[model samples]
Each structure stands twice: as structure tokens, then as C-alpha cells.
Target: MLKKLYLLPLCLIFFVPLIVCEKILILPDHLKNFWIAGVNFDYFSYYKSKVLLILVLFSLISLLYRLRKDEISIKSSKLYIPLFVYLFFIIMSTIFSKYKDISLWGFPDRYEGAMVLFSYIIIFFVFALVPKIKDTQIILNSFLISSFLIGVISMLQFFNLDFIKSYIVGKLHIFQLQYLGKVYIKFNPGPRYVYATLYNSNYVGSFMAISFIVTFILYVLNNEKKRIIYGILSVIMFFSLIACHSRAGILGVMVAVIFFAVYKYKEILKNFKFVAPILIIYLLVYVFINTLSSSYIGNKIESLFVDINKTITNSTNNNLRDVKIYNNAVCLNFDKATLNFVFDNEKIFATDENNKRVSFKFDSNKNEFLFENPTYSQLKYFINNYNNMPVLILNNGYDNLNLIKTKEGFKILSFSGKINNINPVDKIDVKGKEKLGSGRVYIWSRSIPLIKNTLFLGYGPDTYALYFPQYDYIGKFLFLGTPSILVDKPHNMYLQNAINIGVIGTLAFLIFILCYLIFSFKAINTLKDSSLSTISISIFFALIAYLVAGVFNDSVVYVAPLFWALGGLNFKILNN
Candidate 1:
């Protein structure tokens, strides 16, 4: 029973990836809107939370069973001190939070509340306590197999072979096929970015990025026959990572690769004959894949420069010039009567048989627009200027409109007459870059002011959303386009930590990571001659990759567990 209980975590490991499709699981109507601690619990979070609870329970049971038998004794380590300190700070932040519900249970959209954080800590402790070599092997192998399956699915999705995706979606009745379908329509005539079992393409990229590194480490540690297998898996993951079209993932992988090469220079030199051929083959395959999808991949890569330029220019000037133009343009609204008067000779305005104004409401679900009697020029102008304008002219008054492209023409997804509550569209920058990540520069700039008062204790855990609106400089201007948009996360995990738990908590967390790095680096240097040293080195660089990627993405349900689990594994290996 004790042994069986210890293996339960391996089951948890397998189900982690399945969370992507878990939404498909059918739940009763009443259960669908289930609430836990005042938070609306979705099926995905419920399933994951249950699994974690069971795992923690079994781990405790196993520990108690072992203690009774006098077979094993619990040991204390200083490595856990910082983790405890971090947890203490997190609890304090949660207690002092203005939005206690959000801090404790998280937002409905992202359920990484106190419960999830505690589960992560529990998982870390489970791995650290049960660091048996066989268990470690089981966990690592499970990760590789799951990631390979995910990569294959993503590849199939990319190639438009929807059999697997359709079957899975069918099984998960609630899963929205349109979420994936809409990506193709949104970026028509371009390669469809595959998200696989994850929520988004960037997430898939991050998963594959780490998997590629792990496979490389496996290839290094294995025999020649096993090397061939690992090599093939690595190639598949590499292509999958690129196919995700995540700039941060790509940059992170490159950084990790460079770090690995520099750290293992001598080993690489020694194995140059064996490594050179593989490197050449990989390069050739990468080039072939890039050529096949050059248009899609090339455009994504080029956008990095556009993003950088937008950031740089925004730093110097506020980019308020375009905002002023947009405001002035939107404020000059021409009503139906006014439009009819302006085009009195032309039959542009729609009217009823009684000559009354015909009211129109944009259907959010559909992707086509029908003009009652619009001229070609008027229709074209509306389509062209729709996204830039804060509010568009309607029969009643100026209303918000989102012009989305369709096979027929541009259609409005949203239309509302109330200007005060308009869902503002993302504005184009002075350099013509549209939707520059919700004006991240402006958001970050605003975050600085928020941290001024909450320097030490922070606003509280998961309270960034609560405080974000108050200091949102760009949000006020852009609210006309996306009034309902939630600036919940800073998009930078470092900033997220600073705002969530303050400087002390953030430092405690950073110090814990720093200590792990120090110990792992020491282990790598000390065990330089060991066959498994490559694993240590690989994990170190992989963590670095994830850290760099975290600068662009906050820690989320999909990736954070894997990081913490691996960190635990690293600590265990170092201690042993």
C-alpha cells in the first residue's frame, strides 16, 4: 500500500497535459457553475485540484506509513528555508489583500489562487521527499512521452489533419472547436499556428522548448541506440517549437542553447565528430521547415523588430499624438440624419418604408456584414477606419465597433451606443504597429507608480488586477477600443511578483531560485565526469530559458508546476 501510494504522483504527472482537453469532460448544468470558496470553479480547475489533493493525501499517508514501520526518517534541509519564507510572505499578502477572493482563489479566467500555489508547494515537497532514482526516471519518462504525444498532435494540427483534434473535441463535448478554427480564419492565407494540448501557441512553444532541452540531455546520457530515439524526438520537438511561432520561446531556446554550448565547450569539442553530423542534419531540417512556412514564420520574426521599435519610440514620447487624432476623429460622430444630410443626393443611409432610421446591431457571432444601400467608397472607408475609431456612427448615436475581417468583407463584432462603456479596440502606434501587446510599455510604466507605496508588502497576492485600473495611463485612452479588457497580469512575472507580494517576498522567491541555481551549478561542476552531469547542466539552462520567457509571460497553470517539479528534482539530485 505504501509503495502504491508513492506511485500515485506518477499518475498526476500523466494527467497534467490532459488538462488541455479536460474542458471537454461533461458536467451537469448545476455542477458547471460550481463555486468553491466564492470562486467559480470550472471543470478543468476542479479536476486538477482534485488530482493534486489526492496526490498530497497519498504522499502524507506514505510518509506516516514509513514512519510507523521505522523504515525511513524525515530529514530537514536548509534549502527549504527560503521556500517556507516565501510561502509565509505569500500568506501575509493574501491576508492583507484588498480583494481577498481574488487573492485566495484567483480570477475565473486564471485560477492560480492560493489553492494552486499551495498545491505547487505540496508537489515540490512530494518530489523532494520521494527522490528515488526509479521514481525520478518514471517522472522524466512520463514527461517525454506526454510531450511527444502533444508535439505529434500539434504537427497534425499544423498540417490540417484534424482527425485527432476532432476526435478529442468530440469526446470533450464542451470543448469549443471554434477557438482553434477561428485562428485559421483570423490569419487567413497564413500557416495556422498549432497550440496542441495547451491554451495558446506560446504555451505550446514553452512546453516544447523545455522538452527539446530534456530530450537533448537524454540523448547525451544514453547509449548510441537510445541516442537515435532521443535524437528523433528532439527534432520533432524543435520543429514543433518553431511551428508555435512564439518569439519569446524561440529567443529563450536560443539563449539556452548558447549557454549550454558555452558551459559544455570541452565536452562538445571532445564529441565534435559525433555532434557535428547531428548539428548539420538539424540545421538542414530546420532550414527546410522554415522554407516550407517562410511567410508565416518570417512575418512573426519580423514583428519582433516592430515590437522593439514601438517600445523604444513609446519610451521617448508617449505616443499620445495618435491618441489625440483618434479621440478627435471619434468625437466627430455623424448620426444617421446628419449622414443623410451630408449625402442627400446619394442613397447611402438605410431607412424604413416610413422614412424612419433603420437601427442596426452588430452580431458578435457572425462574420459578415450587409449594407442596406452603402456605396463602394463608404463601405471601403468604414472597413478601413473601423479599427482606428473609438466609436462609430450608428442610427442612434456613436457606438463602439470592432471591424473583423471575413471571407466576404469586414464585419463588426461589437456595437454599442453607450460611449461611456464602449469596448475600445486596440489602437495602432505611430509606426503603424497595431495592438502592440496592449501598450505593455504604458502598462509597465503605470505599474511603477503602483509599487511606490506598496514597496515592501505589496498590494497583496493576486491583487494586481484590483490595483491595475487605478494607475492605467494608456488604459484610459485605449478604453474606448477595449473597455472590457482586463489588465490582470503585468505580463512580466518579475513585475508580477513585485506587485503581488512586494520586494521582500519577491526577493525570497528569487533567492530560493538563486540558491537552487548555485547548488545545481556546484553539482554540475563537481560531477563533471559523471554521465548524468549533462542532465544537471541541461536543467540549469532550461530553467534559464523559462526564466527569460517568464519576462514576457507570467507563471500560469500549464508551465509553473513543471518548473517547480523540476526544481525539486534538481535539488534532490544535488543533495544526493
Candidate 2:
């Protein structure tokens, strides 16, 4: 029973990824900038945290008893020094954080706070320090089984066969909470376009980026009968990943395949029989993608081979050339009205649907638009002449438009006559980008300026959202189609750590990961045992795939724990 402690982390990798539910949350006031007051539907992180805490509690008690009895020994101590340094910075950052409550437990939606970070450490250590576990195969199999199921469900969802979206699922999935005034939220399986358990299609893509290659490599490494099963699962995972229509995920898969090929070129040359069948299956999938009954998966796959820009446009829709927002203004050129905006010398010129020209007066002192002799019944309006994106259209009765251009951007007063944070569509200087990753360009440009202030100690764990320029209403409106969405995550994992844990802590984490990668390569090259070599190399390539995906996706709770679990397994294989 005592030796069965390893099963705890297995549960995290298996059950946690499969779980999704709508749970209620009471959000703090400061978070009201985006999160609704005392209401949320946490489909990803809530249950994962519950499982994590339970595992951590049990794992800690067992670890303490073993340490007292001198039953375990951690090898390669120098590799872990940076990990401890990182842990120190995490604690310090949390201690000095302004939003300590949020720093400790994390936000309701993400749940990636100091506590979760601490749990990750314990999870990593459980696999790293545990002596000579015989059931490591079970760990990989558990993840394989879990990912296969996710692939099946995602495939079903892409074809609109998801039972989770049915009425029966809603009636069956209700729970009673105390003091929440009968809080009930519907189970949203995200978009119908192949979003599985993860909340967003982008996150689903990231999750598959990690799992797909691991499953594929397992196919390459296993025996004949087992390899066939893994090969089929690998094909399913690849199809589901394509169904997600996430460009970042596809890029990560490409990187992972390139790295794995180079890493094991010699072995591939030695074992052509083992590698040929999977390659054939892969070619078949690539050729017949259109036959798959799904949403835009066929188009996305074809775009990769044909027109890349179309895929980029479909993926994010924030095409720089065709974007709805531009420098200090929203662009109305792409709208159905086909109206154009020209701001000249503080004068507003609007061409109506009937092509009638109307002029509006701008009062600098009062910060209001004054329309004179309006010939058109409907006219588009911007916050100011300098930045013109059509957010509001005034009726023929003239204008009550209170528009002001602030140093940051533009602000418009609410209809209630009270000053609100209602900023219109505005963007900084992003010129001629004109494609899908342009949205990344918008956020990255804004997020980089904020890093200068957080070089020493960051805002705190999971605190990236608080400092981000959520009032960049124009950027949000153009890229995301709504200013109400919070810029809670920095998408890039490196930027997230730099903002949340400071650049120093990020450097420490980098050092730790670098050391692990170096060690993994050394182990694989020098590994004498056939089975051990496969395990180490598979884990290495999988981690590489995930880190590549992290360039575009944030380390969200739904997918990141599995990466950490695989990290632990690498240590186990190397040290043992």
C-alpha cells in the first residue's frame, strides 16, 4: 500500500485531463474589470485543483515518513538547485504581492496561483525522487488512454455528434452549493468546432501538441501488436489536433517532428521496419483530410500545404491589413456598410449609406462631437478624429456623443451619464502585419512594455491580468470583437512568467529546464538499455513539443499539469 504512492500522480495525469464541470465562484471586486461579480463557469481548472490538493496532501505525508526513514535519495542535486531558487522567488513574489488572496489560491477561471505552483513541485518530486518504481509503463499507458478518449470526443464534437452538448448532460450535471442563492451554470463544451475538454480551441490544440507526439513516439517504440494500437491512436490524435484549427498547435507538431527526427535519425536508419507503417498512415491522413466529417479541419490542413495566409486569417481573424482596428482608432472599412473614415484637423467626415457627406464639429474643451445640418439619417462616429474606428452610429437627431482623446487612447462616456471605463477601439503602432498572428502582435507589443517594471519582483503568481491594459478597448474590440474580455493571460509562457513571477524567477525556471534538457540528451545518447532509451527519448521529444506550443499558448492549468508529470517521468528514467 505504501509503495503505491506513485498512483497519485497517475490519477492527476489521467482523470484531471478528462474532467470538466461548471462550478460557481465569488469573484473579488478588483477583478470586476472583466470577471462578472460573483459568477463564473470554471470548466477546466476547478476540479483539477481539487485532485491536486488531495494528491499533494497524501504525497507530502508519505514523503516525510520516507525521508525520516532514509528510504529515498535524490540524485543529480545540482540540476535541482535552480528549481529550489525558483521556488524561493515564487514565495517571495507571493509574500510581497498586493493581491495576496488571489496570489495564494489563484483566480477562479485559471487556478494557476502560488498554491498550484507548489503542488507542481510536489508532483515533479514524486516521480523524480521515488526509488525504482516498476509501473512506469502504466503511467504512459494511462496518459495514452486518456488522450485517446479526448481525441474520440473531439472528433465527435467536430462532426456535431457530442452528447455533452445534449439536454440530458445538463439535467444530469447539477450540484447544490451552500450560500450561493441556487447558483447554476450550464456545461459549455466550448465551440462546436472540435473543442474537447479544454475550454478553448487554442488550448485544445496545445494539449494535443503535447499528447500527439508522445502517442506517435510510443508507436515507434513499442512492439508489433502494441505498436499497431498506438499507431491508430496516434492517427486519431493528429486528426483531432487538425480539427482544432489552432495554428500554434500545428507549428508545435512540426517542431516536435523535426526535433524527434534529428534526435533519432541514426535509430530510424537502423529500424526502417518499425517506422514505415506509421509514415504510411500519416501520408494517408494528409491526403484524405477532406473525407473527414468535420468543420474547418480540411481547409486548415489544405491551407498548410497551399495558402498559409488563409489559415492564419481563419485561425485568429485579426488580419493586420483587413483588421477592424488601427492606430488609435477602429477601422470601419471592413464592415458591411463600406463606409470610410477620414480625420483631418479635428474635423469629422462621415459618408453615409446613401453616400451623403456630413461634417461634425469637435469641441476640445468639452470633448464632445457637434453635428451641424446633418443630411443623413444614420452616421458612424469615432471617439475622436485622430483615431477613427466606427463604434457608435448617431441618429439624425444629432449627437449626445461625449468623446475625449486621453493620453493612453480614447474614452466615451456611458449612456447613464456616469463616467465608465468604456474605451473605444484603439491600437498602438502595429503596421502592415495584416495576418492571423497579428492579434499576438497586438498583445505582445503591449505586454513587453510592462516587463520593464517587473524585472526584479513581479506582480505575483496569476497576476498578469491585473496589470495588463484591459482598457485598450479598441485592441480588444478589433481582435476579440468585445472590450469586455479581460486580457488575463499573456499567451506566451515566457511573458507570463516574466510578468507574474518576475524576470529573475523566469531565468531560474529557464535554467532548470535547460539543465533538464541537457541531461535528457546526455542520457539518451549514452543510454545502453533499449527500453530505457525509448522512454527517455520519447519523454524528451514530448517536452520539446509542449515547450514549442508554449511559444504561442499560455501554460494553462488544463494542459500544463500533464507536461509537469512527463517531466517527472524523465527524471525517473534518468536517475534510476
Candidate 3:
């Protein structure tokens, strides 16, 4: 039974969700600022890597044994050529990487090293090459079953009854960590970011998207007793997707559904009745959730077009009133008048709303301008995140004033807008739009430049953090709201590949994936009403959905294994 079910162990990947781990960097004197203390937890990547490594080894041996007995060779698959090219580049990158040890095994927190990359590739080759149609069918069923449980847990988390969290599940939960020789556990504080087993809410969004696509495809294909089961699963996964509030996942859903419609147009048209009710239910649920959550769905969509610089500028506009920036100065417009305050060349020049320059006494001892205009005395100000975010507080001094001056500098904290005096070219850059897509733009901008180094080969797999300008303090503080925050992943899969394995390798990876997609696409017409065809089409779109979501999400241990496994299945089906 174990021999027949040799592939069943691959399904264990569904149980391993990803969490950001911190590791104490044992570095040289220069790289001391890398981290204060690392986030190493035994629950995630360490265990995940171990499991994947075992799977890789087992799969490799099994494939080789099968090859010895059959005409099948790994080289026979068209995928091998491109994948080999990608692997070659990754090897070169690993060898040439400054942090060779890290390149081989991955960074301390992230375990997506060269070895792990091979694990992913082997997992792909195993399912794609080794699985028979009958065996693949069982694996697909396992996926749906696992997804049902993931949906249930996510639903529980959404409703604030997360029983699987560390506090309740002991050490089995993903958030358990050991830092500084002490157990540092991440507990759900309350009904906030309901990540479920995926650890990050964004990952949950991406996971649900794949699940939803598969469930939808499977449900649509079945005109039998199992149809209702898959329909319910679709709804569950859809709800989970929306609950996670990941806009990228939503984008993926849109792209996949469009392609799904194109592929299954005839089936959808014939079974319009079956599809209608489910879609309506989805619409109703989406509407209800959005209504309850202050129309965040609408806001999130609308924010994509809105200028982030203006948003930041307007954050404290109520406090500062209408501000018009002049040359090293700003004109504050009010209901009755305006105050023109100039700070050019470290000198204070104040003009009242009456269009007359107010004679302000400079108290050099106290570092404050004393304006004598019968309306105010001393111009005192500071900065804080009062109710909003990084906002400047300026007024008369006192608790009643709210602008009481402390020893702290009147720091801007970090201003993302134009201190550049609004030139014609409009060079606001990514920092100005850091809040866009929840800072995806900032991450992308930073990651794009490193693509140059990867024109031939990358820095190395999972060495993104080591190369990223974590010391861009102003950018970090302004965009990420903290200078000390760690950027572990590029939050984009393609960018991740380009940075880790190099652009040439990324192209190879693209070719490998695109070959599968194109093959599946072309094979759809040849497919009849058989269960194998149904499973094939379903897994095909699931892969599409997962890749689409990868635009705004990096590949993580939680989701990548299942993707690779299923993607391999598609490769097997489409090629055969």
C-alpha cells in the first residue's frame, strides 16, 4: 500500500504554511546592521525545507528507477531543456555569489536557497514525469480535500474563532518561533489580519485564489452528484479570498476567470443555469462583506489610480490647512487669510494673511520664531502619528495647543512628496507612491535595478534581502512607516527570479511555465468528457491563477509546493 501510495507524501505540503523566520546573523564587523536579532522559528522553513528535501530525494530515486524500467527519460520532456538552462544559471549565480554559503542554503530567515530550488524542480519533474493519469487523479482529489480544510480554518479565522492559532494549537501552529534563546510565539491578538495557516494574510489570499479556480473548474466540469460538493468548495474558497483583502489575489482571479471563460465558453454557455446561481451567490457575498467593511473593496480598487503623494500631502492638511509650497517656504491658506512662512537659507520670514511681512523675533536661545501679531506668540511644532499617520503638528505651545515642543527635533519623520518644488518633469518616483498597492511599487522599484546584475546571472536564490538597500532609511521610514523593518521578499515572483537566478534564468523559467500553459491550452480541444480531461483543465487554470497572483506575491513554502506538484501534473497531461 505504501509503495502504491508513494506519491501521497507530496500532499503533506498542504500542511506546511510559511512564516517569516528571524535568524541571528553571525556576520563580520561591517555587516552588523543586517539585523539586531533574527527571526528563526522551527515551525516553518527549517521543517519545510527538510520535508521538501526528503521529497526531492525520494522523487529523484523513484524517477530514476522508473526510467531504468521504461522508455521514459527526464530528457525526453521538452521542459527539461529550458529548466536545465535555468538550473545552469542558478548554479553559476550560486558559485559567483558573494554570500556563497547563503546562496547554497538560503539566507538565515528565508530557505529558498540553491538546494531548495532543486527541490522545487525535482518535485515538478516527479509529478510531471512519474504520475500516471489514474495516480494524478488521486493527487487532484487530495488537493481539493486539503483546500476544504484550509477554507474551514480561514473561515474560522475570519469569524475570529481561530482555534488553530498557536495559543490553542500548542507548537503545531506556524507562528511559533525561538529567538534569543527564548520561545517567541506569535499569537493572534484579536480579529485583525486573519492569516489562517498561511501566516501572512496576503498568502492566504493567493492560496484561496488557486483553490477557488480549481473548485470552480471542477464544479463546472461535473454535471453529477459531486457538482454540489465542488460548488460549495468554490464558494468557501471565494469567501476566503475576499476575507484576506489581498488585491493581487483578486487581480489573479480576474485574469484566470477571463481565460477560463475563453477556454470553457461552450461548457459555460450550455450550463449557464448551473453557473448563474453560484456567481450570484458570490456577488451577494462580496457585496455583503464589502458593505460591512466600509467598502474597502471599492476603496482598494480606487486607490490604485489615486496619487499617493497627494494622499500623504493631504493626511495632515486639516492641521496645516491649505498649503502651497513656495521656494523653501509655504503659503498657508485659510478661510479669511493666509500665512506665508519662509525658511530659505535657515532664516525665518513670516507674512501674515494680510499680505504684509510680519516682523518675527528670532529667539536664537530657544530655536523658535516669536511672532507678535496679537493672534499667536510662539510658533511651536512637532510630529506624531495622531489618529492618522506621520503628521506634522504646528501651533502655539501647550496641552491645549497640541503642538507643545519637546526636546525632539521638529522632524518630518519622512516626507514622500516633492521637497523638489513641483518641477515640470514630475519626478515623484516610487518612494512618493510607497503606499500604492500596500508598498508593492516601492519594492518593485527597488528590485528592478538589481535585474541589471542578473542580465547573465543573479546574486543567488533568496539573497534578495542581502542585496536590497535596507539602509534606505528615509525610504523605509516614509513608505514602510519604520526604518528597522526587514524586507525579506520582493513580494513578486518574477522579480524574485530575476534577482535570485538572473534575467536569463528567469526567461528559462518563463519558457518552462509557458510551455505547459500553451500545451494545456492547445490540448483543451482534444479533451472530451473524461475525468482526466476535467482534472487536467481544472489544474491548468489553477496554475494560471497561481502565476497571476505571483505578480504581487513571492513564492513561499506554504503555497509553492502544491503549485509545483499540480503544475507538474499538467505538464504530464498536456505532454502526453
TM-score of every candidate relative to the true structure: 0.72, 0.79, 0.76
TM-score, structure 2 vs. true: 0.79
Report the number of the highest-TM-score candidate.
Answer: 2
Global fold similarity of model 1 (TM-score)? 0.72
Q: Which scores better on TM-score, 1 or 2?
A: 2
| Model 2 C-alpha lDDT per residue in residues 357-428, reported as the tens digit of each score | 646676657444565633221343434332342233222233333334445443554333334455343334
Candidates 1 and 3 compared by TM-score, better number: 3
Name the regions of candidate 3 deviating beyond 4 angstroms. Answer: 18-34, 71-75, 168-192, 291-294, 301-432
The C-alpha lDDT values of all candidates are 0.60, 0.69, 0.69
| Candidate 2 off by > 4 Å | 1-6, 131-133, 167-192, 286-295, 301-348, 351-391, 394-410, 413-428
Q: After best superposition, candidate 1 residue 327: deviation in angstroms?
A: 11
lDDT of 1 by residue, 1-576 (tens): 566556566446545755642332333342232222222314334455455556656765765666687755557877689889878878888888876777776655456776667767766776666646446666666667877888887787777764545554454343235445432111111245577756567777677778887786566555457778888888888778877787777777878888888887777777676678777877876676678785667678677777777657744322212221121122111212111211222122334334455444334344223444432112212322333432222221222234333333323343232223223333223442234653565566556666766667877766677676532222433422443355767777888888887878788888888888887887777764354565666667888888877777777666677777776666656666
Q: Which residue pairs does candidate 3 place in steric collision? A: 21-39, 22-38, 22-39, 22-40, 23-38, 23-39, 338-353
Question: What are the RMSDs of all candidates, in order?
Answer: 9.4, 7.3, 7.8
